[model samples]
Target: MGSSKAPSWSDQWGTGGLGSDNYEYEEGDKLKKSSSSNKMSSAKAAASAGMDKAKSAALVSADKAKSAAVVGAQKVKTGTFAGLKWFKNQYQKRSSK
Candidate 1:
């Protein structure tokens, strides 16, 4: 008759053994998932910061444009008054002549 022997723990656990290839594969998969989430969070934060900077730049540009427009309007008002004075003096001279 053939001899009988008990199976070892590794034989019983088969692919699910603690130090087996399956265990390492599962651990690697978990690590990959964690790293992927970390990268996504980092990307989102960078995008948010970029948007804030763009908004601040746009607000500054708008303020500068408003100031320029006010200055231009003041110049136009001054020029118009000077022209009116010159026209009045010419008219007076013509009448006297």
Candidate 2:
């Protein structure tokens, strides 16, 4: 059999074959770009869902805290009024004596 000449770099890479401003990329590169774009979209969707869940949890916690604060305020008000009434009764008894 005759000796075969090896293929040149230009022929293998398609550099000076098609035309100017026409660069050829491998199939693997195209597939990688597509797969990366899909992964990015999926990640964005997951992050958005997580943020919404966190926001709902924070709102529920805030509502519970507000209810507790209101109950505490009412108790303080009731205790203050009872103490004032006791003081007034003591003053009246002392004045009568």
Candidate 3:
């Protein structure tokens, strides 16, 4: 009968497991580099989203301010017209008396 030995960690990781110190170190370095890159990408995406939200808010505020200014101008024009009419009527009444 032939005897078989149990597979080691190096067999699973293709010579880059706990048994091989040099290969393990190299694999760890690669993993660290990849993780750092992923973190940087996530941060960049978040910053872009934040900037978009701020721009949208600014646009909404500007539109509201413009609308308010238009309404205010209309009110001022109506008030001035009403005041002038009242003044003319009073002046004519005083002149005729």
lDDT of 1 by residue, 1-97 (tens): 2543433456446554444333333332321112346666888899999999999999999999999999999999999999999999999999999
Q: Candidate 2, clashing residue pairs? A: none
Clashing pairs in 3: none
TM value for model 3: 0.59
Best-fitting candidate, scored by TM-score:
2
Off by over 4 Å in 2: 1-35
Candidate 1 has a TM-score of 0.58
Candidate 1: lDDT of 62? 100
Residues 1-97, model 3: lDDT tens digits? 2443433444546644434433223332331112346666888899999999999999999999999999999999999999999999999999999
Question: Which candidate, 2 or 3, would have the higher TM-score against the true structure?
Answer: 2
Full-model lDDT for every candidate: 0.70, 0.70, 0.70
How does model 2 fare in lDDT? 0.70
- What's the ranking of the predictions by TM-score, best on top? 2, 3, 1
Among all windows of 10 consecutive residues in model 1, the one with the lowest summed lDDT is 25-34
